[model samples]
Target: MRIRRVVLLMAVGAALAGCGADGEPIQPTMSANVGVGTSGTYGGVGVGLRRGGLGVYLGL
Candidate 1:
């Protein structure tokens, strides 16, 4: 059982390192973000905005 698990893990690792669809270049998405800064941050009651956008998902 342990050997089987090891083999399975190795196979998965190899698959991830290969020319999988997940390795394709993708675009960044934009969305609304609102939060507060912490830990010595200058911004207070942070009110930042971002443009809404879409992105691609290259799945394996």
Candidate 2:
């Protein structure tokens, strides 16, 4: 699992490193996400938003 996560992160990093190579201006965009997880004794949900270079998150 650790190796897989490392590989996935490297792949994403490489992809993002190549973005905007054509000299195009960056555009503002808004996105929302939700995440949930649990362990042996606890779990929680998180909500998040990202706009351009800014981001926000809330967890419960």
Each prediction's whole-model lDDT (CA)? 0.36, 0.46
Candidate 2 lDDT score at position 10: 49
Residue 29 of candidate 2: its Cα lDDT? 30
- What local lDDT score does residue 33 receive in model 2, on the 0 to 100 scale? 46
Question: Which runs in model 2 stand beyond 4 Å of their true positions?
Answer: 24-60
The top-ranked prediction according to lDDT is 2
TM-score of 1: 0.32
Clashing pairs in model 1?
none
Q: Residues 1-60, candidate 1: write the lDDT tens digits.
A: 655654565454444435334644332322333455665433212111222342222211
Q: For model 2, which pairs clash? A: none
RMSD of each: 14.2, 8.7
| Per-residue C-alpha lDDT of model 2 across residues 19-38, encoded as one tens digit per residue | 64575433323233455556
